[model samples]
Target: LPQTIVDTVVTTWRLEIRFLWIGSQCIIQDDNHDKVIEISCMPQIYGNACLTILASRSSSVTEGFLHERVISNDILCAKLAVKVFDQTAKIAHLIPQRKNVELEPLYRRAWALQERLLSSRKLSFGSLQTRWFCREMDDNTSLKDDSRDGWTFRERKGWEELERFELLGHWIKIDSQTADELSTQWYFLIDTYTSCEMTFEGDRLPAISAIAQRLAPRLGDYHAGLWGRNLLSQLMWTRVNKSKLAKDATPSWTWATAVGHCRYTDNDLTIPAATMLAMLAMTAATAFPTKISGAASAVTLGMSVTATAQAMETVTPCFILATLRCWFTLLKY
Candidate 1:
């Protein structure tokens, strides 16, 4: 085991936790079967844990996170004196910069993304200080000492709260309101997850399998990185930049096949409705040509069909039907 992991174990013991589930130690690395089972159970393990310790400061296992942090001396602090009715009080104000968790080495790892999201409470040992994050509150030890001069730290509470919402939203029961909401959030997650570095291209889907498993109950079916229910909307994902397809068994239709950052088409009217419809239609034709050519073509279009149905309120349904009939007739030939 690496020293960082040993330090983590020691930290867990200090917290009085009896058992610790170290991925390297608990899972049999040599056995593929064991890895698959363990990886699938990640959601349960991390979600149920009382506390998850993150070595955010360490890039690799060899560089232990327990080492001292080099505090910068460039911080500015001002002491002010205020006169009350009878007495004078002094206040020391320290300007602090918020730490960006995304910049952390551990945050870049593909596996760590799901691990962090799954854990209810995370105690991250960052380069700046030891931070505590949970659904209720997020704090850091650096802020406790008011007398300290250099570089006070402020935890990014907004980002932490957003993460908590993302975690909770997945487990919530699926309803009309939550279904679309959660599906949108899932796309946002994919945008972030795909940007992270992965050592093995094949592990892309497996790394996020726990998240998929957790969401499967609410989202219906799991089809690669895309969900089954709103597959047409999900297929609206587009690559951010030029990227190559993965040399894996994953189908080209899914985002998992591409080894690059991708984001969903923003429904904010920035993209023309016609263009969006065309993209959705093309995605359907490419991904499910058989289904698109069959009687269930409108059903397979998912949200695109709904949008067209709404538009039909202004236009004639017969005209639209005839147009689609001609289109499909040509598609068949």
Candidate 2:
């Protein structure tokens, strides 16, 4: 009986999400077909086990719906923490892992990325406040309410008195301004029917294809390569762009599109082995000759890292070729 209810709710939520994200490229977790609403089901310690629920997986769906606002905020915070840690770890590999200094920019960047995921439509807070404020907090913020002037987080006098009144619904702001920003965004209150649309806007085809092509042979798993490529692209995008719109707004184009624009031929993975090899040979033809004219050991070490990265870029084709050859050899009985 519980499973049946969960399934019904889950299916509806999925449909709602699909309607919201009409034409964007998003990779959603394909599992969890149940729609039973729940709160904080994900294991925080495991880190990557963050489950984005459609409804909830709990027996009592109402409890899940009621607790969602606070839980949603917590989930966003946890996701951001994970990003900060992961990015810091990766950046440490590019340079020496040093302590005593904080990566402020990186943390900020991570927060922005988290915001994009949690509040992409700029309507997350409104959804929570409107839906749960009156029921959970007993603070009604409706169109008829005199406080319709603005939604302020600032604590003002007599604000506590307003808490006694039952919040009905939120004021609709068709256009977004600093004052009306909160009003415009959707707040998913106890009204289980409430949902918001999200747009998945970002271009990362080439990068994912490139990583997949490279890692396919060595890993003996084409899907793994593709998955890795997709995962890396997602991480990088999330790390760099804080908001989905920001990520979408970015004019970041992939090399595959820039090189040539045919269905299959232009794709770097599908290029001729000989032609690709020749390009690598030309690039690697001058590895060490481009040394700095006058640089001390410290400067040279920094330059060495940069030069190594550049050299790797040039020889990346060879790595791809080797991966292909390895895959072919495995396939040959």
What total of clashing residue pairs does each candidate reach? 0, 15
Give the candidate number with the greatest TM-score.
1
How would you encode candidate 2's per-residue C-alpha lDDT over 1-333 as one tens digit per residue?
A: 344334444544764644222111122333222111111111121112222222222223233332343323222222232366457322111111111011212111211222222211221122123211222232333334433323333221134333211122122111222312221111111011011111221222221222222223332222211122222221111111222222322222222112121111111243223222211111232322221111112222221111112222322332222112211111111
Residue 17 in model 2: lDDT: 47
Instruction: Tell me the whole-model lDDT of each prediction, alpha carbons only.
Output: 0.63, 0.22
Steric clash count of candidate 1? 0
Estimate, for each residue in 2-83, the C-alpha lDDT of model 1 and write its tens digit: 8898899889888999988889889998887788778867888998999989999999998889988875555443444666
TM-score of 2: 0.17
On a 0 to 100 scale, what is the lDDT of residue 226 in model 2? 19
